[model samples]
Target: MQNVVIIGAGQGGLQAAMSLRQEGFEGAITLIGAEKGLPYQRPPLSKAYLKTGDADALSLRPASFFEKKQITLVDGTHVEAIDRAARRVMAGDRSFDYDHLILATGTRNLRPPIPGAEQALDLRTLDDALRLRNALDRPMRCAVIGGGFIGLEFAAVARALGHEVTLAEAAPRLMARAVSPETSERFLALHRDMGSDIHLGDPVCAVRADGITLKSGTEIQADLVLMAAGVVPNSELAASAGLAVDNGVVVDTRMLTEDPAISALGDCAVFPDPVTGRAVRLESVQAATDHARLIAKRLVKQVDDPYGAVPWFWSDQADCKLQIAGLAAEGDDTILRPDGAVFRFAGDRLSAVETVNDAKTHMQTRKRLAQGPVARAALEAAEFDMAQV
Candidate 1:
């Protein structure tokens, strides 16, 4: 490959460019993004940025790094279309040709269709976080829509800032999609203890200038409303380009699309689970960076290795840090350890481990999961002690 063009200059896109250089590829690299400014980390936007307002600390690399790495950084440009025959992408009137293209389009916040929903704000981007921070400068009653990680994180921060927070979730429990009922209950309690009014099993049906109205006709009076319901993958561009798209841009285990010249990764790409072989799309920094490295190695070293990294995630809420090791399905069974760690099992095989403020156990569980599947029977025999197992 003589020229590599990476779209969406987020974590995955930036990593692809850097990995390509690290793998000794001297090709011309162009990293394009729709947002303006240097590529920054998104995970901190909800946690630390809301408090410190340190946009600089969130930057993955300095501006000088891009120049020294010989990577062309194109910000504030949205790729319009892809010409498969010409192997080039069009951005406005400009065009970029690529021997290889990496699509790291990422995702956009899902704004549910509700009456006056436009009045609600989002926390997906840096600009969005800045706006929310400014809104929090004064004492304001905040109502958060959604019980997912972003919503809970923001609620915790808002509560810490002495703002009255009211969170509404459609699900029966918080983080129902991502965590087990046991873990969800723990976080729900944590948030409640932090002085946030949380309402479960009730979703915000409407957003007015004053506040939000839940599905139960409960009107929350708040000056600021945050829409953290969820996010949809930004896959329209790939679908328009005739690339296969499922929940996200469909890619093989190798992270390559139907066309060998194009590869997709990060939140926008759905690939097979390395362990379960089921199609999965992850939204964590680990998956994005790992996928980028695999793609880069495949391009530079001509390796055809399948992506097999263990999936892990973390969310900081109030004083609690919840860490999950491995991926677990919705139907997976859970075994709660005596010390509060939750072990999820798919049939007899271990699927995931959840820990709060326990980095040692979290790292150990990740290493164990990476080695191979652990049997529930083994854990049972070992008395649910991971070390013994």
Candidate 2:
């Protein structure tokens, strides 16, 4: 049995440890994290946790599970550096050797340069969420920067809480990087219908204590400002240790880095897309957990399967639930289904399907993608639903 040392005790790192044990690998597993307390899910920090404030519900597994599984969890300790020559990791003054190392450090919210930007809050980690939650206790006009998933999610929640919410995006549409133009337009209407002042293609130039001023010189008065612009991959540790870092820690199809002794997963690692071979870093809980399981299987049971799992994502904005089954690159053609579902096609191949408030369709599309490809003619036939297709 090999000794596995996992960095970043987030969803991915924790899953890697549990998956290793589940695969019946009787080996030493150490999960190191910089965050204090237990590892928690960050997605709900902006969605459910904003309204509920349940820290217990966010945890992936309790401390007892880690102990019972013999998974050594080291919390509140930052991994200072990596000694590649000795295959050891430095956390403060302590060091731990490993037969294999998995880096699942995840990503941190990108705080762009704006005047008095520190006054703006973030919605990434648990601490950020808690601070924002506490700030929401009093009635306040809030301006949210960025139109990404987390930003939009926060905007939706804030608007529901009777806060004067203004959502500003540098891009013309919401979730520009991930979702299609059609989906972006749909969400824009939804948020606007809910009385949110949504600004597109405009970035905030300054974040004053009282309000935010956009680049166009339009001032949006608000009591709170949330900076949800985007996230930068936490790959500095891996990159510093001589691993390739392009946007994220570059890994092969097997999720192994150039060193072979080290592997990276979750939002921090850039791996080749199973279908397109294009390098991409995903920030979904599904991707993180699945990537961890893939690495675990490879390390333990010697299941050398390529990372072929289909990519899927979900975002809850207000009452609408946006679900995407696959990664439809920018150039993909989107076909609007009869039920308002959007099916994306890259040339003749099915690229992705975007559905709002349609969990069944989402699950079916994901299953179909896993079942392999369907003919373009079959999809266009209308006789074949996503399931039969």
What are the C-alpha RMSDs, in order, of all predicted structures? Answer: 0.7, 1.1
What's the TM-score of every candidate structure?
0.99, 0.98
Which candidate number would show the highest TM-score if scored against the true structure? 1
The alpha-carbon deviation from the true structure for residue 80 of candidate 1, after best TM-score superposition, in angstroms, is 0.6
Alpha-carbon local distance difference test for all models: 0.95, 0.90
On residues 1-389, what C-alpha lDDT tens digit does candidate 2 reach at each position? 46899999998899999899999979899999999988888889999999999988897887789889999999999998889999999987799999899999999889897889999888888999999999999888989999999989998998899888898998888898887888898999999998999999888999997899999999999988999999999999998899999999999999999997899999999999998899999988888999999999999878899998888898999999999998988868878877889888888898999999999989998998998876678888855388778
26-129 per-residue lDDT for model 1 (tens digits) = 98999999999999999999999999999989999999999999999999999999998999999998999999999999999998888999999999899999
Candidate 1 global CA lDDT score: 0.95
TM-score of 1: 0.99
lDDT of 1 at 162: 97
Model 2: runs farther than 4 Å from truth? none
lDDT of 2: 0.90
Highest lDDT model number: 1
